[model samples]
Target: MAMDRELVTCTKGDGFWTRRILCTIRRLVRLSAKSSTVGNMAVLILSISCIDGNLLNAFYHAAPSSEIIRQSSMNSTISSVIFKDYDVTVMLFHSAYLVDIEQTEKGRVMKLDSLKNGDIWKTMDVLVFNSWLWWYRRGPKQPWDYLQYRSKIVKDMDRMFAYKMALRTWTRWVNSQVNATSTKIFFQGISPSHYNGSEWNEPGVTNCLREEQPVDGSTYPGGKPMAATVLRSALAPVRNKVQLLDITLLSQLRKDAHPSRYNGFKSMDCTHWCVPGLPDIWNQLLFASLFS
Candidate 1:
């Protein structure tokens, strides 16, 4: 029988979250014949934040398979693709938030909910989740009709409070539903951005635009973000159940690894990292945690 192992990574955006990890897995499989020989090939299933057909296409094409299956489209909530010979099946689900939260976009307020109701969680054997960057937005950039808590709805609440509440809901679902023995869960820690040059001791720079190297040190000059602290605090109760992939400090040093203007040039994108860059390291760490 083929050894079945499941891994899940939850994060926003198509950049550092999914593609980098996918690429790392693909490379590892290619390098190690042990993956197929030991009948331990990985079948990656994802709960995607948004639909990016191009990213899926790129992954499928780069993989070692002739019979590639495309089961859904951009508008669909779920999409599946199978790598015929490699025993890899990737399913992408559309989700913007880890828990039920109200988001406003283009004058329309949308309610983002948890994946607890979905059948995806039932089969999830390994899970990795991330949420940050989105929580910092304000005004029109921050898309939310109103903060929803139980029976109460407010115009706004403390970002940390909302984050902690959302995490509480998520942990509750995991504790109740997920099989602790069969499944392994991980939370990808807050990925830091290099928007402020002063954070890295360069005050004159505006953003991570033309920078081409990471900050030279083991520690970030500006120290960790309060979001990271909030994450740890929220996860404290459930830390035993879920492992935290602490990529914050390491990622903070990679100030120059962002897509910056190359992504669009419309605005500086210091949030997401460059593909064959820092995220690759993140995935390497993930791969180590999964197999080693």
Candidate 2:
């Protein structure tokens, strides 16, 4: 019994030092909110390591277009005050073909799956997990047969068994340390990006440029039932080990947040999010999960 091939390559994070991260996030948050200057200064420090450097284009390879927003998302309202007041750091990795996790090992890509138990988990205070949205896709041709898809999954591997191994690996690695309570791991539930506006019944635009993007915390369109269903099923094993950030449901509600209107071009991307909206909500929720 093993996970289907579609998701075999999509394994995301192996939580190692959970307790240490939780404490760090809590402390940083408390300290950052005490003073505006301290918070802003802390943001500068945290933002430096947050950079992936390999990112090139915003829509395509831009340093995880959502990273800046995920950070800024914490700065929006009282949440900004809360996050800035602390010295906590959220280390996350996101990309377009992340589901292709295996191919990552072959090149210069930063592979989240390659992380051993205590290896990189020791490097950060909190690790935000994510990976999905690309698994159920037929790539480009819309392999529209759902039954065929499900059968393909069952025939290829036993989904439950695959999850068990993944969870075992992650739990073993994360629980090995006593400071597990300080480390917190969260999985940003499958985020939908606008591939074509037609999926939402609003046909208009596609693609995004970093310069013309919206600020952090703004909502926009993008979602699909198939992707959500697949993610829900795949996330079953690590349910207790990681908090699921439900960005999929929220993104579906904010349909008008697309960028076509601001940039004057049909760039209403539905797959990934624009700044100042959804990604911020994701970050805010991550912060609240740590404290509350």
Candidate 3:
């Protein structure tokens, strides 16, 4: 398989593409003829537990003191050989790096400048992360009713500004908490969505449904989205510490690769990709970077 031996799986959240990566890891190992597993990891610390939505009050409440976890090497969840007979073990803890929360007089609000969870970032060999979609969510799709920044809660703010704050909160932890010498970090660049046809130069197209052709050149006609600039700016502080897999441009050129209607599954899924298609290329890119 992908490891010199076996690969195990454990998770607290759903990442359909994350699962895909685990399945193809073995193939990547086979293709590269190389095994990338490092030494025995003490505990692949991922989690699925409860936390007070309000961090500002955490200091006053002793019940939430559990955040001061026994800083161990990490946490593990494998009972047997994950792959049965293989030689490597990989624990998938696909989690969204949660920002903090504050209880405001009006309601609960999400804090963008701080992280209330994610102390589970253990000393590991490799770390891969991708974010951005959640920042765009609004209405029922958005979880928090308000956003807290700089100690003030507001109904809303500039999304790009909020996005940068959240990212800074994450990157700051990476800069301080992680053992950079022993671990390698990778950030998958902004994965584009095909919700707007005008993004690909076809104004009336509206969606990826019935789309059959790739955008003709290396550069997409619609040009780079503003989110790309915001994302890069956020990662700039750790430019050397994190390797960004800048797939935005290339992905922007392939509007036809989205799941669209996905063979009658979701009527419209322009954000997600089709398996055995675009994600395969992402896997290849991941594999290449993993080995390189």
lDDT of 3 at 132: 72
The deviation in Å at residue 221 for candidate 1 is 1.0
Q: Which candidate has the highest lDDT of all?
A: 1
Candidate 3 least-lDDT 10 residues: 48-57
- lDDT winner between 1 and 3, please give it: 1
Ranking by TM-score: 1, 3, 2
CA shift at 60, candidate 1, in angstroms? 2.0
Ordered list by lDDT, greatest first: 1, 3, 2
In model 3, what lDDT does residue 173 have? 85
Tens digits of per-residue lDDT for model 3, 66-113? 222221124422111133222223434423434765576777688887
Which ranges of candidate 3 are over 4 A from the true structure?
1-39, 42-98, 101-107, 263-266
* Every model: Cα RMSD to truth: 8.4, 14.2, 11.7
> Which stretches in model 2 have alpha-carbon errors above 4 Å?
1-24, 28-118, 133-180, 195-224, 261-268
Name the 10 consecutive residues with the lowest summed lDDT in model 1. Answer: 1-10
TM-score winner among the candidates?
1
Q: Which residue runs does candidate 1 get wrong by more than 4 Å?
A: 1-43, 47-58, 101-115, 138-143
- Candidate with better TM-score, 1 vs 2: 1
lDDT of each: 0.63, 0.38, 0.58
> What is the lDDT for 182 in model 3?
55
lDDT of 3 at 44: 24
